[model samples]
Target: MTEVTDFFRQGGGLSDTLPSFELRPGQIELVRAIEKSLSQHTHLVAEAGTGIGKTFSYLLPTLQHDKQVVISTATKHLQEQIFFKDLPLVEKALHKKVSACLLKGRGNYFCHYRYEMFLGSAFQLNKTQAKKVSRLQDWVQQTQSGDLSEIAAFVAEDYAFKKKITSTRENCLNSECPYFDDCFVQKVREKAKKSAVVVVNHSLLMADIVLKETGFAEILPETDVVVIDEAHHLPKIATQAFAEQVSSNQLLELGKDTLQVYRREAGDVEGFADCVEALIGAVDDLRDALADARPNGQVQLAKLKQFKRAYQAFQVLMQVFSEFLHALKALAERSSDLQKINERAEITAERIKSVFSPTAADDSHNDDTERQAAQSVAILEWHADYFKACRLPIHLGNRWQNVMQAYADSWLFVSATLSVGQSFDFFIDSLGLPADIATLQVNSPFNYAEQSVIHILPDLPAPNQHDFVPALVDAVLPILQKTKGRAFMLFTSYRNLYEAAELMQNSDFHLFIQGEHPKSQLIDAFMQSDNAVLLGTVSFWEGVDVAGEKLSCVIIDKIPFPSPGDPMIAEQSRYLESTGRSAFAHCYIPKAATLLKQGAGRLIRSNHDTGVLIFGDNRMLTKSYGRQLIEALPPARQVDSDALFTFIEDTL
Candidate 1:
């Protein structure tokens, strides 16, 4: 077989196979390093910058390797890009037949059982939902895989109607479900099992790994190689996967299900209605206790209104419920629903307990990593009408190490934003990888010096100033005029985004504001418009791709810092401070810089792509940490505000 690295040479397989394939030394180096890592059965951490064809560099080697590879990325967009776009190109380049599958989290697939249930409840929906969902009725019959993304001109994300007609861990009935044989999730899982390359998102990948160990319905086949793209996100995503959460919604559903199940299966069972009444009372009491919660709805348990007292009562209530289930379990054998209800009750009670009571430090493992993993914080969050109490892991460094070690022999972590100034120490240490783990950083094959410039918007007020957002809008207005709104105005928070959106609402150029439309539609509108500017928060900082004249500039509102008010970040910062660490240096700077890099990367996506990246945050010039942030991004030329408009004009 031809060597995988040779596929990148000047007259190599890719050159011959792809007319546009250029010989990139950085791509070749990355491929050679990854191939060596896979062949040797060791761990590797690589930072493959944009325009380096990072996808192909990893795909080619993993495809050639004689092992089943599970490629997990941060987003479904990239997963589809790799499987749909990158994979086929590599296969053709190598002229080798390969099998690949794209498996999303279960909810992405349509549920026949729920669809029928939804049809029954269709009368209750308002006219708008009724109209939108009516389309799915016809499509469901003809669709084979049942993946909603396959449906054109339909939005399935973050829609409450979609949730009601999809499957969740709490709602799924598994083999007992009437539609078991036709389960879309099952079909995809079987596909994933047989394919050599299974592509999944980080959340699904983590869930599968954790679920497989517990002997649940497994999602992937035995994994021989695990390649993590956008690996920087794994630590954050892992904490969510490992954390225990119990919500009022869960309790309410349990009560409703128990009542219905009792009426249908065990009418003679005593205490069913009374137990449900107690559950409802418990939920009310818990919610009433939070009546004085901060308006933002994120409160540290200790700061909550009579939280300690309410929590104590809540714990006792769960205990009583658990006791009721224990007694009920005696008659649970009378029906499978009864048995399942009993089990669900027990699990909910345990989660409530675990979320509230984290274990004290255990001396069983003197390792610092273990000690950090053991530290956890409990938080109360209100979402719309319900609240979820979650136990969040302080850090995932050691826990992630164990997961990677136990799951796959060859572990490869790659991302465009894995390093800060050529040092992968922060990324490595945060992930708890050893210092000796093979490390590689290859700059983007695109020439940043020739293709892009960073224009730090001059004389802007400090971000905390009440008038700062206005200043940002004022400073960037002329640039938008020059570029004619063919730009992305990214913000760190909605405050900035809203302020900018309002200011630009009357501009001659079209405005595609985030939250006004789905991210996909907003991006689509921006791409299709002749003169339009897209305004978005942190979400738009990355994962946006527009080439040629449609996107000629990226105007950032501020340094993209993770909000301190964020419950998880707050708890982690508090924990780090308690251990005498500088949370800003250890936690804040690296994360913010990486995010800034991602935003800057939105420009100059291809070698032919060129644009001006304007930073409205004055800190990029005044603060000491600003230098580090600049270095973290591609080495684009730094210009003062005066010259930036001219640069934009020339580039466009």
Candidate 2:
């Protein structure tokens, strides 16, 4: 064994220093592969199953190398695990000193400027609100770590105030602000600068690369490695970050904030009234045009685009005042007498510019740089982020791509659902990975043939059919009896979740519904309850681990495929079909296979765990694609519906 592996081994040289742990062959192979790949600067896609010890597998090699590495995960919980629990344990095991730091997005930390605004909002309140605000004030004064998530009770009571208080990227003053030295964000980055490993979430990682607003290069330019855990989430995250969004509510907030600044600075000044009037009128005109154009469910873009054209023209009026405010700030910079008024005016003008900058076309597009800048116009027509005539195009896939390229030192994209049938082509294509990347899949460690039972309910109603929910309930009733109420009833839609929860409400079984409680709390309650059935949607299908007797059965309501009418799906389908390809076979079926595998994965959480998966949807048995889906699941016993209950009882 290598020195690093020996350090991590149980009862080895560093046993007294490091946490006791084992290194399996799969994990060792993963580490060796990563070490080899990083040395050659090659890309890798490793499929490490749940029991493969993936965490230590990568960390040991990373710590051994004389390089800086950044690790990112899908959730804050996992980020904390790597930084707080896993990294410390591994470093101790190796008997080496490796600096590490944890960083989150800017909004999590307290902004002195916004906090000041929050303080004003607190005092300008009624009796009950004042008492609550006072408590918050006291807490804010004492908090060493100003994470918003720490303020548990306040989030539930004062959501609006909380939003107002959260610091935004556009509004931060950086070095010019009074709180720059005391800033939590800066402090964390400073720590990251000295550390070899920096742990962050996928969203923040994306913001650093694509948004270019997070200032990642300032710390990461010298870094040699990056690891992205939960690689499956990268594509969707990319699309969201790369895309832009503008809503009516956003414009209203901008106007309100500008109005507040105007009132506070110039005491209902002359130019302020005209600016606010034009802003409100322009927003109203767009809303009216949109309403008249589309008397439908969601606003259609075709009509909104026309409204945006007129809205852009109306936005020019604010530019006149903005220029005047700019002159005032320049004058105030020379004289201290008008500093406060000048500064406030300058801030307000910039706010207005941010609102309209995305839509307004630049006349200075002669050079290559300017042309690139002019081409990327934000389409959002409302709020501080909107332009007049364009909508911000939001692409979630691009956002994910930026993250993988940015902060991660080594990204391990692992999921039981990453492949469709026998191919990883769909997911790989979606991720936009470079050619010559290395890929590996470790077959599930479970003895699927001995432990798992897959039974597909054939000839069932369509998922959207009215009888589907009743039929699904009927199909699951016997399965639940066999397992005696220890089951996860996974659904694809809210309607189905509601129906399932209501149908099983009074069965002397604890019924938990999604959105009724915080997800973690709901899971904890379900695990603690002896006989409980949790009814949930997509998120519950994956990233859930309930081992031992707590989870004995998994009943899928139906196959989850993107709805045809969804705007993104429609656009993608049109694009693909235009290229003369079958979207159903190439796109939809493969996508369903991956999601189905994720749902089925919940059945077998550990080596000691075993359960029956009942896919209530009839398509699995009747369709040719059913074979692929069944084959994708853990190697479970194949049994007819009649024998499933007896099998569950016999296994237990």
Q: Go through the candidates in order and give each one's C-alpha lDDT.
A: 0.80, 0.67
Query: Candidate 1: where is the Cα deviation over 4 Å?
Result: 112-141, 152-158, 215-217, 267-271, 274-296, 306-331, 359-374, 574-580
Model 2 clash tally, residue pairs: 35
| Residue 450 accuracy (lDDT) in model 2 | 75
Please report the TM-score between candidate 2 and the true structure. 0.82
- The window of 10 residues in a row where model 2 has the poorest summed lDDT is 387-396
Candidate 2 residue-wise lDDT, 234-271, digit = tens = 77776555544444444555555555555555553466
In model 2, state the lDDT of residue 162.
66
- Superposition error at 560 for model 2 (Å): 0.4
TM-scores for the candidates:
0.89, 0.82
lDDT of 1: 0.80
RMSD of each: 4.0, 5.5
Q: After superposition, how far is residue 166 of candidate 2 from its true place, in Å?
A: 2.0
Q: Which candidate ranks first by TM-score, i.e. highest?
A: 1
The candidate that wins on lDDT is 1
